[model samples]
Target: MTLIGRTHAREIETLSLDSADTRNALSAALVGELADALTDCAGDAGVRAVVLTHTGSTFCAGADLRDPPHPDALVGLLRQIVTLRKPVLARITGHVRAGGLGLLAACDLAVASTRSDFAFTEVRIGVAPAVISLTVLPRTDPRALARHYLTGARFDAAEAVRTGLLTAAGDDVDAVLEPILDGLRRSSPQGLAETKQLLTAKVLEAFDRDAADLTALSARLFSSPQAREGMTAFLERRDPSWAV
Candidate 1:
């Protein structure tokens, strides 16, 4: 776990999710570390841009289901990123799926390698991608979300870009990252902060009301028979007819 911040070409902060074996799952510890790091970066006057890249072959596999943190803990970390003043960039190089995609969706800018993949596997695990809905839903088209949410399907870099989740999908990791970093440098740090604030303001406005809706929806969703049936069917290698 490394959160390094500096000022040279620009104010920069990076989250080094160095858990190679876990592919950088958002465990409680990691989320705590990230929350602290993001705060440090946002607080620094010199830091203009942020690069959120991970170590090893994969970017992040989301959260390890073995220990899903308390909803407050996980949502707390995301709320920081969502409200951060500095621009944040997600630099992806390898496989991204399930909760990993949720983390990427939190970033304002995503630059992924051509070889990388994007997937939402929550439904397959018998749960919906509810937390990520706030970040990804607004970015993705209605039809695309409908398709992906229905099947918990996998899509590649191109589809990710077309769906508006990724800003640039390049042939490799370095190529994808360079332009984004450069673009951030060229823009005014103050302007970036203002724009980010504007975005955050709008998101937060809806978020307060929508959060209540999400809690209600998730409570009903998890407690319902449909969720149990869906989980069983998924484990049994069959389809779920939720509307049934």
Candidate 2:
């Protein structure tokens, strides 16, 4: 199924990655759907907040590396999420890895279940976490960031929260999501828009002004020897030497 976008009368908009059969891999079609949904949500006067989520067990296993969509697409989506003009939240369930960390990190708030897991696994796959790392680094613990991107270690939701990748670990995922939606509902729509813009400016303005440099950065990283080695190791089911 394609990515599904839904908005409620309560002013909560959700964009769900709906290809549950493939673990919701971010393919070209899915990313395009997501981008369109984001644009719609951004322009909607009634949307107070957005909750980004996926349909099943894995929140997202990252981009579809097998005939994956254009590399530029991931960066573009990241930029869209960063520049969107409303509060965005991430609801995490299980086994989030690689660019999934970027998805979690992109949002203003992330709520995870205690059983959920998170990892920045790009380095293990022979690629730098170049696309998502820029936004994630500030929201995460420097040491945890050090371990994650380097080791590709998966930590629990509690650890995710401690590392600032998550705001809280909820006992009941749906229950927690309700209050979060309600809390967002209380904020004035105008205030939410302005706040979102300010938040983006604070984090992205310093370096990513036009996202021009990002292409260079991603190209260098994706083509590096390290990226090749890491991705090969992952496909072969082995630990990457990058950790050693």
Candidate 3:
């Protein structure tokens, strides 16, 4: 079954994460499908911009415990988003957690509804937000990320924008994105691609310098004892032994 639903109109392509059954978790198949779709968008001259959105209440709930993608694959997917020639924008109106924030950060622009909430949930699962930091650290405020990364607390859309996680948030997400999409529609394809490259240089640098280390770290942590206990407890709907 297809996990991504695609639609295009007026040169704008919309890719929706359609795996609501798993809360659109980053399963291996989902990741691979998304990567291929993105590559197609990147090569299509008729596609002016891409909108990454989701079908369910949760935009994404991080890596799928049942069928997670390899750490290296996750890193590559994030890098692809950061380096995609045409602009990629995230249109969110739901909760985002853990690795999903990495996807949001990789996008050139992100807008969400005021109702959306976000959290870095990796720490609760006995893993750091290691792989995601490549794109996230480059995009967000260090101090804000420090607190959220360590505590795994939930923050609202306004706080997300203040911390540079979101470009804007509003009562109506579509209303918020319309003007931005109009601007993109007006922009020359070459102008958008070149400007996006100029904007994403530092983000790509982070991927170049730190991706290998972070991917290794993520793989190690996910295989460790603590993560096993955390995952088990999470599936069982109980607290891990480390929880107070």
User: Which residue pairs in model 3 clash with each other?
Assistant: none
Q: What's model 1's overall lDDT?
A: 0.74
Summarize candidate 1's per-residue lDDT along 38-71 as a digit string, tens digits. Answer: 8888778878877888878878777665455555
Candidate 2 regions with alpha-carbon error over 4 angstroms: 5-9, 206-211, 224-233, 236-244
Q: Which stretches of candidate 3 lie over 4 Å from their true place?
A: none
- What lDDT does model 3 reach? 0.95
lDDT per residue for candidate 3 within 1-244, as digits (tens), equals 9999999999999999999999999999999999999999988999999999999899999999999999989998999998999999999999999999999999999999999999998989899999999999988999998999999999999999999999999999999999999999999999999999999999988988998999899989999999999999988999989998
In the order shown, what is each candidate's alpha-carbon RMSD?
3.8, 2.4, 0.5
Candidate 1 ranges beyond 4 A from true positions: 1-10, 215-244
In angstroms, the error of model 3 at 236 is 0.9
lDDT of every predicted structure (CA atoms): 0.74, 0.77, 0.95
Ten-residue stretch with the least lDDT total in model 1: 1-10
Residue 81, model 2: lDDT of 86
